[model samples]
Target: MSYTDDERIRAKRRALYILAQRDHSKKELYDKLIKNYPPDLCEMVVGLMCEHDLINEEKYTEKLYRAYINKGWGKSKIRFELRRKGLPDSLISQQEEEYDTEDFIDEIMHLVDKKYASKLDFSDYKSVQRVTAALARRGFAYDDIKLALSRIKDGDYDEYDE
Candidate 1:
């Protein structure tokens, strides 16, 4: 679809205004602009922004990944959110380059100690299941949650346990 110069300028300004509020993936920018602009115009505007180094999906992904990790979220949840926000698999895969099962295990343990300590009970099967379910909802894998709970139950103390 052909776009007028005026339409292009307006769309570009709108895109910049939207981006100024916060970082957005190119897909996100296009999605937002499509609400008011034509698809072709959105694409052209986004491409221009990309050419100018204004839209950096990598930086956005890195920031979000770290934030989710610090917030005690697991990789599955992070990937879900990134995809939800319009990031493609290629970009999301970068976060997995140094993947380590141990990283999420530590996060699981932190959540158990900090949030569920008062409620968790290894002896009570129902209590254990409840905690496990909650952690799974937080995107933690079943095996990792079980391992973390076991570590605590067996008195395999870490510094935090002391």
Candidate 2:
């Protein structure tokens, strides 16, 4: 059966509403729309939105990258999230360069210090292993983790345990 013009307009309006909720990659928005509308109609609506500058994959990718970085996610996790959202590899690469590596290292260190402060014991191998594993899971490299751990003062650990 064919859809009426009013129905097509309604579908396009709904698609725009969804886009307004957040930035969406072209493929992601299209997939969402196709679930409720005809594939061809979804494509048409997407094209119109692009023409109006309402749907932009580059802008969407950049926003997603910024949001993820602000949440203190590392490059690997950020890349994975962007890929899952259908962002191009080149765009992801370009956006990743905008993240400050020093800031990321500081954030990782802050998180590690908070979580392992009370558990630290310089003489205990198991404690060091646990702290290192925690930092690694937070997306920090081994060397960075080691360096941060080295900077944790004995007094800080003692105070935390108290």
Candidate 3:
């Protein structure tokens, strides 16, 4: 089967509509269009979109970073998501510098604090280990997790001694 001129136009328009809903990397847009159109035609459409400023890798990368940050994801998780989306490593590296490590750590700390607030009794080693694992899963490094855990443990100990 072959797409007519009208069908090709409609497919391109539909691809753009899908992209309009959210920022997509160029490879992603190309892959989506290729599902319905020929590879060459999809490449042309992607090129046209780029020329028209409809799809920009840099802008998409920045938007992705901010979106993940807003969702409280750490740099490591954000980097991985961006990579999975087919974003270039250089682009991700450039955008990574825009995020401060301390800020990411603070976000992790806030999440941990809120989650463990009620279960602060620290009844056993398992509790601390569980909380540490939770923070690690959030993309925090071991040192940061240990520091946050230490603070929580110290706070609990003081409360119990009194």
Model 2 compared with the native: what TM-score? 0.77
lDDT of 2 by residue, 4-45 (tens): 999789988887898889878778888899888888888888
Better of 1 and 2 by TM-score: 1
Q: CA lDDT of 161 in candidate 1?
A: 69
lDDT of 3 by residue, 55-161 (tens): 89999999988888777676788888999889999999998887777666566666666566565457777877877777667667778667656765566333333
lDDT of each: 0.87, 0.76, 0.77
What would the TM-score be for candidate 1 when compared with the true structure?
A: 0.93
Model 2, global lDDT: 0.76
Best by lDDT: 1
- Using TM-score, give the best candidate's number: 1
Backbone collision tally, model 2: 0
Report per-prediction Cα RMSD to one decimal.
1.4, 4.2, 4.5
Q: At residue 96, give the lDDT of candidate 1.
A: 58
**lDDT by residue for model 1 over 1-162, one digit each (tens)?**
888889888999999899999999998999999999888888889999999989998889888888888888878898899999988788789885655778888888888889999999778999999999999988888888888788888876485665
Once model 3 is optimally superposed onto the true structure by TM-score, how far is the C-alpha of residue 27 displaced, in angstroms?
1.6
Q: Least lDDT summed over 10 consecutive residues: which range in candidate 3?
A: 153-162
